[model samples]
Target: MFKSVDLKLQLVELLISSYANVDLSKVKIIGVQHILETTHSMFRSLYLLGLKPENIAIIGKCYSTCKEVFEEMLDDGIYVDPSSSSYCSHKSYDEWFSLNIENFLTSQIDDLLSGKYEKILVLDDGGKCIKALNKFSINTNLIVAIEQTTSGYEDIRYGCFNFPIINVARSATKLNIESPMIAQAASERLYLSLQRKGLKTNKVLIIGKGAIGNAMKNKFASNMEVVCYDRNQKTYDQAKVELSEIINQFPLILGCTGKISIPFDLHSKISPGTVLASVSS
Candidate 1:
């Protein structure tokens, strides 16, 4: 029974607390189709913060689901692509439309420089749209970008977008649609299923000391006997485990190392019931 104001406050709290001590006035939100709903929530939150609807703009592909969600909201101040007929139908009012990333970039930049917005908030890496936006001369004083996957991080770094990017790690794209509570319930169900099947603490082995590997290690540590293996000598030393010893000891493995293949004969070392879960990017 979350009220709109409660949801808005939660989003504002997340956005503000995420950057800690940063100004959030006049920010433009950018994302792809999948992030549309989340962006809508953000829009409501920003509006509740006393910002006008005209100050915010969205740049992404127009999809039926997105259209349905946007249409349901009374404040249709979002700027969409003109070629997208679904968005075009509502173009007469507060709607803005563009055909491609190039056009969207041009228009958004103009709006930003025209003393309309002060900050820019990138919700998710909008495919190549982020890269395209990077080529333009943006006028905002501060830029905030969010990343959910390793691929998005690479995109922000390599795209040469001059902005302070924040990586908000999320589950797989499909699982992101479910609320965090629901996803946790689903994970608990899976864990119960495994336990009921007499699975003896699936010896979950993670390979890599990077952020993703560390996250996986933390997640599976409570349910399974977890071991981490990294090629980096220093990291292995820090973890107090040797790769060779791990390779020789366990057959259940998750390869988080960036390497294409495990260094040793992984198949021949483990037992028949050993399970491998790869979390490598």
Candidate 2:
């Protein structure tokens, strides 16, 4: 079902070649949770690259769409499922908890204290691991970090950290090349959802004019009357006004903004049967 399996393999090979001389067993990995099979394959490749099974930790997301498959694929590493208790608890670690907190930090600190790893590598999404680190004092060496989402980068951009973080979220390869495909896939899915409900609309309102929003606007322009509005575009365009004025004008509303594009007060202004979809995290 994953279309990017080949590309994921290429990434694995690139990582393997890049760290060919380094001892992977001495490196501690902290990564984000993802549902795609391609993400699972990437973790599996890392295990095969001689990184200690226990050294690799997969932090759980706020919600899991593929927990069973993830656990089955990466059985050796520390599996931090928010729904369960801590797997590898430490006496010194605090008892903080949340829906996505599965004691990931505790286990990693325990391993570090036991002299299991000399360096830490963070592969994060939405800045989950970075936020977790801010909660406690980590005395280990953090070498390098990679964040692959714009929201995640924004979260850590102003914050102080010991390591150099790479922002793959705003990279040319992701924004210029991959975003349009993502928008296309999202549009196709939205189309299918509308078809299943037998809903038809002549007008669509897009809430953000960023990469995904702009691509989505183009995608729907040929099929329906599309209107795109962004906070940044209000300065020059007359049509780019507050959402409340045009909230009921369109039968379909799509939120391309990663944050809350629509507030609670505006929800009452929307048409009764209008479909709302968000293509962003």
Candidate 3:
């Protein structure tokens, strides 16, 4: 237990050191829900960098589980949308993401009683946080906004907002390691579901030759005969079967491309009991 906490502290140290040369003493940030493991470290690191406890406000209840969301020691100061004992009474996740959270946060931010913040942070994979901040009326000189989700990064990349966005979601290390592993896990979940349905088979069709697609191919190849596809000529040349011909032949089809690269025209050819999984956005 101590070892894990110690590792978290070390990561905090590294994060703090990244800004050691900068004059961040005057920066005031309001962090919303963040990944569970890093939230404590992030909160402590910001305070050590010279921000006051009151200057940092946190939102959201948990990460992957309810236990991770409702915590007694998670906050030292301002807390919004906290997962208290009555958390079950709060709006459902869909309702919160759609309007409740945006309304609540926007109301708090428009009023100075919540403390003026220069930045807002979020990781819920919902656009409401950004939408709320976009409508903020606080007196502080709000500069840039930061995000911690792949879908949020999609919004930034597509020019959804006018402000500068720092997408910590696709940090170089994460794109190279964390994301591929997560994609692999998705593939595993798909395989397990297929197994539960008594649909295990040796032949599989994997689309995309990118990191995630390739990872899925490798992870699935050991148990199944795998055929990979991509729009690129190089990838197509290496695959043993034509994309059009394999759709009807394979019992399982997975699209690993980051976008919708799978052809809808071929959907009609799929076997009746086909199992389809995708990691596309």
Report every candidate's CA lDDT: 0.54, 0.70, 0.59
**Which run of 10 residues does model 3 get worst, by summed lDDT?**
61-70
Model 3 CA lDDT for position 176: 80
Q: Residue by residue across 1-281, what tens digits does model 1's lDDT show?
A: 23332445464568755666554455666544342455566666665455555655554444433555555333556655443333556443113322355666676676656665566766654334555566677753556666655545554555555766665544453224333443254346646766697765556666776555665666677867777666665345366654555565554566655343364354565567765555432
Best by lDDT: 2
Least accurate 10 contiguous residues by lDDT in model 2: 90-99
Model 1, stretches more than 4 Å misplaced?
A: 1-27, 31-39, 59-76, 79-115, 124-130, 140-201, 205-208, 227-281
- What TM-score would every model get versus the actual structure? 0.48, 0.81, 0.59
lDDT per residue as tens, model 3, 1-281: 22122335666688778877654444555545643445555565666677665554455533232334334324455354543222333655444444545555654564333354444333334344665666655442444667765655655466556556667767886568866677777877887888798877888877777666777877877888887877555255365555776678778888765445556687788888877887753
Q: Which of 1 and 2 is ahead in TM-score?
A: 2
lDDT of 2 at 185: 93
TM-score of 2: 0.81
